[model samples]
Target: MSFSASSPVSFVRAAVDGEIARFLDRRRAQLLEVGSELVPVADALEAMLAGGKRLRPAFCYWGWRGAGGADVAGIHAAAASLEFLQACALIHDDVIDNSDTRRGLPATHKRLESLHAASGWTGSAEAFGRGAAILIGDLCLAWSEDLYQASGLGPEALQTGRVPFDAMRTEVMAGQYLDMLEQVREDGGVEATLRVMHYKAAKYTVQRPLHLGAALAGRYDDLAPVYTDYGLPLGVAFQLRDDILGVFGDPEQTGKPAGDDLREGKRTLIVAETLERTGSADRAEFLRHLGDPLLSAETVEWMRGAAEDCGALAACERRIDDYVAQATAALETGRIDATARSALADLVVAATARKH
Candidate 1:
């Protein structure tokens, strides 16, 4: 049998994709009544949702299965609602970062900005794009709840998932504020940076999704602890890999410009570690160019070299391996459902070990 045949996540991804498409198709016409101009709003959302690996939904699906929930269509739709939450984050994040592209195309804000310019709108195109994108993000956040409420699960099941669903959204928004704060502070060191990762990626990306799924299964207490232990470390490793990619990944594969993170001056663990490992001169130069919007390729290359030469890059890689090992070990606990355990093992690898 194919690996997917036995994998809850693999099956749910396909199902969830169909559900989202159907949901958007119905909403598109309704939204057009507000204004024909608003059609592009939904268009940007559709495009953003199209290309992700659906990792959040995967974790949620397996979390439910691991907690003994059966594979039902209602649960699949509930699991798929996580993507709408993710879309909210990405749209707002792109606006905050002033990113030009996402998933190899113009970001939502950029697309809206282009729309303004092409139509001879009277205001600043940049301001219009930013405003429109924020509204889009808010709409996605609202629709996430709509999807969850309309998921057709039992009342109790929906109630169970609601707690984590609420917590996840609140925590991520707080984490996003922290991330913006870090960029402004002169020093956010490893400890502070990791704090952002924990709230932003660890909790928002994995732990809550898994908990939300387990809650939907009706006996979250059975697997909640195990899922937390597994999810947090794995989530951090996933973001760490993303940090590596943000600086060094192939632009085509990552769907963003090379060194975008460095250009934006994100206070990632990788950058923090590099400062600790490198000498004062290299550190000074790195900081000077860290947030430069017009940072040059030669300067980025030099900074990358400095980080590598100081052994920071190798250390970060080692940290990723260590976390992956911890996350994998959590699945071995005897309390876990056997079939779901195997699927989650595959998910651990998929979540952390990716080119994107």
Candidate 2:
């Protein structure tokens, strides 16, 4: 039942992709049978599920293996369910951030907006797009639940998985609201921003996946604390890396414009640090241009240099390394099988080492 670092990554990817395709195919037929009018919505859902790297599913699979679960079918289904949840989140996230692209394709909202405009649909194109995207996101959420219910886990496993899923969804929604609130609040300082990052990105992205995987393996009592020990620090590192890539990664690889995070005014730890360390003039300039969607490449380069010059990037790197070390140390404390532990450790490295 154990997997090597190299094999697990590939196996997890294949399993998740297969499960997602199967789920989508079945759901597409069901939606079509419901009515012709729901076709676009179904297509949007499928598109949103397309072309993801499936990292969340990998995390779930490895976590289950680490907890000594041997049922590949059960683990695959659970992992696929996580992907569905992720699709729901991403679709809504793009709408909230007003992002135009995902995975190098038009975002759900943008695609819907384009269709509305081209078809000369009655009502404002923007409103129609947002409404359609919202419905698509909701559909994904419903399918997420349905898929999880059909994961073929026993009743006992379902009881365990439900706890983390419920908490994860609730906390993520709250985190999303908090994120929006932070962008507008005059008094939202560095602390507030960090809190939002923990709730919105860290816990939901890494911690919850680990918890769900462990729950599926019926090792919640033994592995829940391990999630805190390993997931929290790793989750933070993951987001810090994401923030770095959002501002600096190649647009082709990241599937978004450079400085997109800056344009969205994401209240990341790096941004908070930059705000704290920069001088008054530079700080004023940064604040003025922080969320301006019209930012040029030159301005983004300047902001990047400013972040490095003010020690924000260096500090963020140090923090990432610290978390990586913490996760490594926690792995030593865990009593999982050596092979499973090795796979999870490799995952920690892979997740944190990515450039995009």
Candidate with best TM-score: 1
Off by over 4 Å in 1: 1-9
Model 2 residue pairs with clashes: none
Instruction: Summarize candidate 1's per-residue lDDT along 270-330 as a digit string, tens digits.
Output: 8999999899998998999998888888988987888789988888899899999999999
- Candidate 1 displacement at residue 241 in angstroms: 0.4
| TM-score per candidate | 0.97, 0.95
User: What C-alpha lDDT values do all the predictions have?
Assistant: 0.88, 0.83
Evaluate model 2: give its lDDT. 0.83
The weakest ten consecutive residues by lDDT in model 1 span 1-10
RMSD over all Cα atoms, model 1: 1.6
Residue pairs clashing, model 1? none
